[model samples]
Target: MISIRRFPIRIALCFLVSFPLWGCASIAQWAAPEKKATTSAPVEFVNAEQEFWTHFHAGHYDRIPQLLETYKRLYVLHPDHPVIAARIGFLHVWHLSERMRMGEPKASVIDDATLCRKFFGEASQLDPKDPRFKGFYAACIMAEADIHQREADTRKGYYLMKDAISDWPEFNLFTGGYVMSQLPWEGSLFDEALEWQWKTLDLCAQTKVDRKQPEYPAYATQDFSGAKRACGNSAIAPHNFEGFFLNMGDMLVKKGEVPVAKKIYSFARLSPSYQQWPYRNMLEDRIRKAEENLPYFRIQKREEISSKNPHLMFHSEAACMACHRTND
Candidate 1:
C-alpha cells in the first residue's frame, strides 16, 4: 500500500510538470506578435452636444460661445440631420436669450439673436409642423424683440408669443406670455397688454388643469400643480410656479388685494414644488414683509389717528393688540 501511494504521488508530480509545459507551448503557438498601442481619436464636436448642457448647468456660460461655434461648425457638416438642426436651433435660442438677459453689448446681442433666428428658421424649414421647432422659433423672435426694446419689436414679440400659445397650448408659456403681457404695458400698449395678461392667465389656468392629468406630457409640465397634466409625455419642462405666483401676488398687492395676495404668497412658500428654487426664498421674504405690514395696513384708519394724536396716552397697552391679533 505504501509503495502504491508513493508511485501515484511520483506520477502526479510528473503529469503536473508535463501539463504546464504542454500548455505553455500551445499558448506560445497561439499568441500573435504585439503591435504598438493605438491611441483613441478625439470625439467630434457633434458628439460633444451633451457636454454643452453640463457646462450650462455648471454655470459656465462663458464657455457657451466657443461651444456654440463648435456645434455650429459640426452642424454645417451634417446640415440634413433633423436632430442636428433642432439642437442648433435650441442652443442658439437658449444661448442668445441668456446672453441678451445678461445685458451683453448690443452688437453681440444682435449677432446672437440673428444666429438664433437663422437656426430657428432652418429648423422650421426642416419640419414646419414640429411643435418644438415652431415654439423655439417664436421664442427666439420674442426674446430678440425684448432685448432690442423696440415698441414695434414688442408688438412682433407679442404676435410671436401668441403664435406659440396657439401652436403649443400644452407647453408652459410663462416666460413668453409674461414678457408679452408686460411689454405692451411698458410700451403704453395698455389695451394690448391687458389682453395679453388675461390670455396668459387663462393659459396658466389651463396648464394647471392639464398637469393634474396622468397622461400629461413631461416636457410641457412645470412644477406648478398643473404640470403633471400639461407634460403628458415630453422631456423639456418649466421651473416651479413660485416665481409666477410671486408675480401674481405682487400684482394683487399693488391692486390692494392684500388678503388674496397673502394667500397666494403663502401657497407659494408652502408648495413642495417650489421649495427648492431661489424664488422660494423670495416668496418667504415677501411673506414675512406682508405679514409685518399687513397689520398696519389693516388698521390704516387707526394708524392715521395715532399719528394725529401722538401725545394722547392709550388707556391700555393691549389697545393696539386688540385689533392687531397675531391671527390676523
Candidate 2:
C-alpha cells in the first residue's frame, strides 16, 4: 500500500489490542490426530478446571485472584511443568492485559510484565527450545514496554522478536512475534512497521484454525507439536491479526495512499480468524472511511510539509493515486 516515507505523521493512535498443559504434557504432539478428537483430563485437573471454567465463563472477573492462586498451587505441584507456568502466564497476559489497558486498580495487584516473565519465563526456561514460550516471553517484554514505557523492555522485546521470528518455523507464533516487535509506540515512526504489518497480515490470511473452544477449557497435558501447550487454543496468536492490519491500513490512509490502503484492507475479508472492532462490519466501513478521508490527508500532508520543512515538496494527490492504478 502506501509507502511509510510518504505517509504523513499523524496523531499517536491508541489501539486496544491463552492455555494450557502441564507436567506429563509435552508442549508439542507430533501425532496427526484429528483436531476435533477429545482427550480426557484427569479427575483432579477436571474438577479444578471446572471451577476455573465456571468463573471464567460466568464473567466473574473478581475471581481472577482465586484463579491465580489455583494456578499457583498447580505450578507448585508441577514445579518442572512449563505447561502450568504457561497457563499462569496466559492468564496474566490475556486477562490482565485488558484490565491494564483500562488502567484498572485491580490490574495493579500484580506487575503484568513481571508475572509474564515469571510464568512464561519459567516455561521458556523449562523448555528452552520451544518457540511458543520463547516468542511469548518476548511478547511479555513488548507488553511491558507498551504499558510501562520501559526502554529495556523494548530493546529486549525487539531482540526477542528477531530471535523468535527467525527460530520459529510455524506461521502463527512467529507472525505474532513479528507484529508485536514491529508495532509502533507513541509518536514513533519506523519504516519497517508497515512491512511487518503486511507480513503479519499475510500470515493471518494463510493460517487455518481447526477448532474453536471456549475459554479455560480443560486441555490435556501434551501439546500438538510435543512441547508444553499453553492457553489451550489461545496459544497461537489470533489469526485475524486485528492490530496488525488496523494500524497498517490506518497509517496508509493517513499518508494519502487510500488506494493502496483499500487493496490492503481487502485482505481482511479473506481472513478466518475471529473478527473484532472494525472487522465487525467486514472492514467495508473502515475502507469507506479511509477513502472518504483520502483527500483531507493529501492536502494535510502537503500543508504540513510546506509549513514544517520548506526545503522539500510533497507528492501531489494525483501522483500518489497514480502509484496504485491498475495496470490492465
Candidate 3:
C-alpha cells in the first residue's frame, strides 16, 4: 500500500470531502421472556431491530448469532418486509466484518458477502422507493467485488450507487461516498467521494458550505425542517453526526489538509449525544494527533486497516458502537 502523501494530488482531489427504534410497537411487546431450554422462545418481529441495537451497542458479540437467527425467522415470516431484509443484510455485513477483523478464512468472508448481497438486494428490490436499501445493495455488491476481485461486479456496484444517489441525493451521497472511501485515497473515485461529502454538508445545513470556517457550532444551534434521522441525534444512531465528521476529517488528513481536518474533527462535538459517545476519546485523540497520526495511517492499505482501530470510522467495530449506542 502506498502512502497517501506519495499519491498524486490531482486538482479534483483537493475539491472535496443509523438507526432507530424497531417500530411503532411498544417496548413491552418487543421484549420476550426467557424460555426453558427445551422450549422455543417467541420472536419479536416488530422490534427485532431494536433488540439488535441493544446487543450491538453493548458489544455483546455472543448474542448476535441468536439475534441473527431471530431475524432469519422473521424474514421467513415477512418476506415482503424490506426493513427486515435490509437489517438482516446489515447484520451479515457486520458478521463478515468480524471475520475480516479476526483474519478469518476467505471462504467465510465470501459466504458472508454473498449473503449480505442477497438480503440487501432483496430489500432494494422490495422497496425501490427507499434510497438506503438501494445504497446498501450497491455497497454489498462492491463488497463482493473486492472479495472476489471481479471488475464486472465493481462496475455494476458503481452504477447502482450512481442511481441510488440520483434517487435520493441527500442521504445516498453519504452512503455512496462512504463505500468509495475504502478505495485508495489517491484515486479520482476518492476525490469524487470527498466532493460528495461537501455536497452532503450543503444539504445537511441547507446552505453553502465553507470548509475553512467552523459551521458545526451553527449547525448545532439552528433548527432545520426535514432533517433526516441519518443527520440528527437519533436514539438508534446516536453518533451519526460524530462518525460523519470523523470520516470526513480522516479524508482531509489523508489529503494533507491537517489544519482543515482539525476543523472538521470539531464538528463531532456539535452533536448533543457526544458526551455519551463511548468513542469520544477517539475524536479527541485524533484532534491532538492530527498531523502526527498521518504517517501511522499512511503505512496501511486503506482496505486493510483493521476494524479494531477505534479511530477508523468506516471499518472500526466502533462504527457500530458509534452509530447505534443509545448511551454509554
**TM of each candidate vs. truth:** 0.53, 0.52, 0.78
TM-score of 3: 0.78
Candidate 2 regions exceeding 4 Å error are: 1-43, 46-66, 100-110, 145-149, 169-189, 201-257, 271-279, 282-285, 291-328
Candidate with best TM-score: 3
- Identify the candidate with maximal lDDT: 3
- In candidate 3, what are the lDDT values of residues 83-163, reduced to their tens digit? 778888888777765553454324555777888899998888777788878988998899889878999999899999999
* lDDT for predicted candidate 2 compared with the true structure: 0.48
Give the count of colliding residue pairs in each prediction. Answer: 18, 19, 1
Query: How many residue-pair clashes does candidate 2 contain?
Result: 19
Worst 10 residues of 1 by lDDT: 311-320
Arranged by TM-score with the best first, the candidates are: 3, 1, 2
Where in model 3 is the C-alpha error above 4 Å?
A: 1-44, 98-107, 224-227, 299-304, 307-311
Per-residue accuracy of model 2 over 1-328 as CA lDDT, tens digit each: 7578645532122121112343224545644442231223336555667776565434454566777788888766666766667768866765544342232235363486678767887887777677768777877777677667788877887687668766653432433433342233222433354445444433333332221211111222213342212111232333223333444455566555677766655544443343432233524665877766454443433124222221101122111111111111
